[model samples]
Target: MEIISNEALSRCIRDAVRAELQEHFKTGGSTGNVSRERLLSKQELAAELGVSLVTLTEWMKKGLPFFRLHKRVYFRMSEVLETMQQKI
Candidate 1:
């Protein structure tokens, strides 16, 4: 059997790990805690979903989707994912 030295083995492992991370960073969508970030303003919601401010307010007021706190609004990543799954 062929064997590589310790340093060569480490280098190859590091390169493979780096490549995997690069692919994750490039293509992994917001499928985790990132969606649970701080409260986003209505305008920010519209920007994220590519909707208009009025549409956002309508959706919020109707309780269609979104997290709300008094006059504030936010979103949890998991909630969004679940809602999308349901729609499918």
Candidate 2:
């Protein structure tokens, strides 16, 4: 058995991640695919909905599904749209 070098391991991980992202984007680009999950920043979501950031915050308070990683917040586009449909 041979030990993998740190550089080789890092390169392998990077390549795997790149491939995964390329596949994700490829499948996610179709409009009729509802299960394609994509993350959006708060600003992006607000712009997509044609709403202000303040209004987005209000929506969060009203139970919009969101994820927080440290100081960053993300919204899942599919979930957001589903929530909107239910509310409507």
Candidate 3:
């Protein structure tokens, strides 16, 4: 058994994480691209914006763009950001 220094261990961990992230990106499993806009749940958006679900519902009533498939609602992150920017 060989002893590894703290710096060497840290570097090894960093390189492993970097390679995993790169592999994830290559497999289209990471959110590193803006072109691939993802639809988020109302709860997710509310948490992301630090707002309540009721407030999000109010925004929906006030013309916040959303998609409804059956009873579920989805919002595109990019569209939500753009709309919020326009509002401000």
Tens digits of per-residue lDDT, candidate 2, 1-88, equal 7599889999999999999889878976565745556689999999999999999999999999999999999999889999999999
Global local distance difference test of model 3:
0.92
Candidate 1 residue pairs in backbone clash: none
Score each candidate by Cα lDDT: 0.69, 0.91, 0.92
Candidate 1 lDDT by residue in tens digits, 1-88 = 6588889999999999999888877866455555435566667667887889887677666554676688677765455557657767
Order the candidate numbers by TM-score, best to worst.
2, 3, 1
Structural similarity to truth (TM-score) of each candidate = 0.40, 0.59, 0.59
lDDT for position 28 in model 1: 63
Q: Clashes in candidate 1: how many?
A: 0
Clashing pairs in 3: none
| Model 2, C-alpha of 47: deviation from truth (Å) | 0.6
Candidate 3 lDDT tens digits, 2-87: 69988999999999999999998898885555456778999999999999999999999998999998999999988988998999
